[model samples]
Target: MMNLDAVEQAGEQIWQTRKKMNYTTLGLTVAYTVQMLRDGEIYIPEYQGHIVWSDKKRMRLIESVLLGLPISEFFAVKIDEEKWELLDGVQRLTTLDAFLNNDIQLKNLERLSKCNGFRFSDFSALEQGKFESRGTRVVLLLENLRLETRLDLFMGINGLDKQATL
Candidate 1:
């Protein structure tokens, strides 16, 4: 038979433990986030699954940024004061990385179809500036958070029924 008292004790312990976790939020620019990705300040773990977003989806994300729309927040865990492990938004960041490096070409954009074939390099200075200047919100899970908690949070966020495409 199940031990009801022990189960309640365990639940209480979990609630008490989670009460001590810390987090912070920051609004950072797309250019800054991309720069961090390129510089290795922010990265995905090898175990974090592959990038599955299609090219058209990627273009739509970039289009949202360029058009000043609010993209979803990125969630990351602090590895140190200077480094972060991306828990959410891997696909979005990977798309940005691939596009910025000219590895992927933008295509099939609905409203911005005129620039469909363009890579990051193809954008004019003004267009590039607009793209880079847009802000993306980030939520940082502080270093004090335990690995199990971080993993649970990551899994919970990713396991949602309606996955965030942005």
Candidate 2:
């Protein structure tokens, strides 16, 4: 049988440990984020799942950014001093990655319908500048966080979204 005093002490220790974890919020430009993805500095875990956004959905998100609308924030954990593991915003990041790499073309955009069928390479210089200038907010769990804490945080955040799973 478990000792009651020992269990209470263990629980207190866990609570104190968790209180010490630190996090930081940053606003990163689309250009910088895409560059990091290309360089493989951002880790996309398998649990975040595949890129499932349709062309229309992807296009809409891009249009929102160009229109300076607020997009959802991303959650990531620092893997090291130089690398980050993305916990949320997989779909958003993957869509941007694909679009920037010209692997996917924008289509059926509502606000920017004329941009349909155009790859990032086909964008005018001004359009490219606008796209790159847009920024997204990121909440980073510092490296001091335990792996299990990070995983729990990821699950808790994603579980509330109907589109995400373990």
Best by TM-score: 1
Q: In model 2, which residue pairs have backbone atoms overlapping below 3 Å?
A: none
lDDT tens per residue, model 1, 139-163: 9878746666666777788883224
Model 1 stretches astray by more than 4 angstroms: 1-18, 160-166
- For each candidate in the order shown, give its overall lDDT on alpha carbons: 0.81, 0.80
Enumerate clash totals for all models, in the order shown: 0, 0
lDDT (Cα, tens digit) per residue for candidate 2, span 16-46: 9777767889999888887887788887877
Q: What is the lDDT of residue 161 in candidate 1?
A: 28
Candidate 1 least-lDDT 10 residues: 157-166
Whole-model lDDT, model 1: 0.81
TM of each candidate vs. truth:
0.82, 0.80
